[model samples]
Target: MNVKGLDYTCLTLSIIGAINWGLIGIFRFDLVAFLFGDMSWLSRIIYTLVGLSGLYLISTYGRICQVDDAR
Candidate 1:
């Protein structure tokens, strides 16, 4: 995927992860687990992907700053 596509995907996953964390903190609920069984392989994979997405999103800060500077 192109950078923009990848960025969007990462952002989306990161947002989902954040929402999951919010639910966990507020209601002791895990949306992934609720949907995919408790700590199942699929749930673990989802968690891992979310984490990687978060890491990928870290680079977005520099990209955003560069874009702003370009204008």
Candidate 2:
């Protein structure tokens, strides 16, 4: 199966969230908080979106398996 545009978006957001987590672990820095404000509405929204994107990406495992199996 081919990946959809929504999958691309979710994957991108997940990557961004992962990067933010890495920064927090390594440097106690938060890119989202810095850009949007600490726990502000915008930051919360971004956090929520990133969380949702991570959740959505979980479902992609089956799609990925199908593509790999085809190959």
Candidate 3:
């Protein structure tokens, strides 16, 4: 149940990203772009950061699952 701090942070960001996507699909709202201003450099930076967080989660989950399978 215990996760590393970085892992936890990445997971939290990933959840935020997912919720934003849900809103976009269901309500046509882009939360990140709205909060940061669409097409602006700041918004783009946030988008990139969120994407990196998701990638981190993917790699972390893969490593954790591999360890569990080895046990």
Candidate 4:
């Protein structure tokens, strides 16, 4: 089965955001913030990207999970 390119990109970004949050919970470190500097515009942009990526996942979750489409 071939997944759409956009779906793959969104899924990859979602996984990245999830892992970043997981690290934050366990280590009190935000990787994106650390690299971009907290409170900086770059940091905010990273946060926003992650948030939007998550929202995209929520919106598309059902559509992506249709069993018939997987085959």
Candidate 5:
């Protein structure tokens, strides 16, 4: 597996999740819910994917940071 590509994907999803959280915190808006309906199956899938991506990033963070620090 190409970890580089997977890392990018995870980072992107995590960023999207973060932005959604920020919107909810500042404006009480839920973009996923707005797009897919509250607690709907599709929205739940999206939420799950975003959460999984965040978890993946957490696992890879230390390695990623070490690589950056080496440069």
Candidate 6:
């Protein structure tokens, strides 16, 4: 995928991860763990994907700034 597409995907995943964290923080609950079994293989994979997406998004900072500058 192109940079923009990748960025969008990463951002989406990061947002989902953030929301999950929010839920955990406020309610002491884990949606992924609830849906899947607590720390199941599938849940671990989801956590890993979310973490990787967050790392990928870190690299998009420059592009984000450039876009803002253009506006």
Best by lDDT: 1
Per-residue C-alpha lDDT of model 4 across residues 25-64, encoded as one tens digit per residue:
9998888878888869987877787778777778576875
Name the runs in model 1 displaced over 4 angstroms.
Answer: none
- Please give, for residues 1-71, the per-residue lDDT of candidate 2 as tens digits: 35688898888999999999999999999999999999999999999999999998888888889999999
lDDT score, candidate 3: 0.87
Clashing pairs in 2: none
Q: What's the residue-level lDDT of 32 in candidate 1?
A: 95
Q: Please identify model 3 stretches exceeding 4 Å from their true place.
A: 1-3
Among all windows of 10 consecutive residues in model 6, the one with the lowest summed lDDT is 55-64
* 23-56: candidate 6 lDDT, tens digit per residue: 9999999998999889999999999999999998
- Provide TM-scores for the models: 0.92, 0.86, 0.80, 0.72, 0.85, 0.85
RMSD of 3: 3.1
Give candidate 6's TM-score: 0.85
- How many clashes in each candidate? 0, 0, 0, 0, 0, 0
Predicted structure 5, TM vs. truth: 0.85
Clash pairs detected, candidate 5: none
Q: Residues 1-71, candidate 5, lDDT per residue (tens digit)?
A: 59889999988988999999999999999999999999999999989999999899887879978999999
What's the CA error at residue 43 for candidate 2, in Å? 0.4
Runs in model 6 deviating more than 4 A are 66-71
> What would the TM-score be for candidate 2 when compared with the true structure?
0.86
Report lDDT per candidate: 0.94, 0.92, 0.87, 0.79, 0.93, 0.91
Clashes of 5: 0
Best by TM-score: 1
The pairs that clash in candidate 4 are none
Q: Provide the global lDDT of candidate 2 against the true structure.
A: 0.92
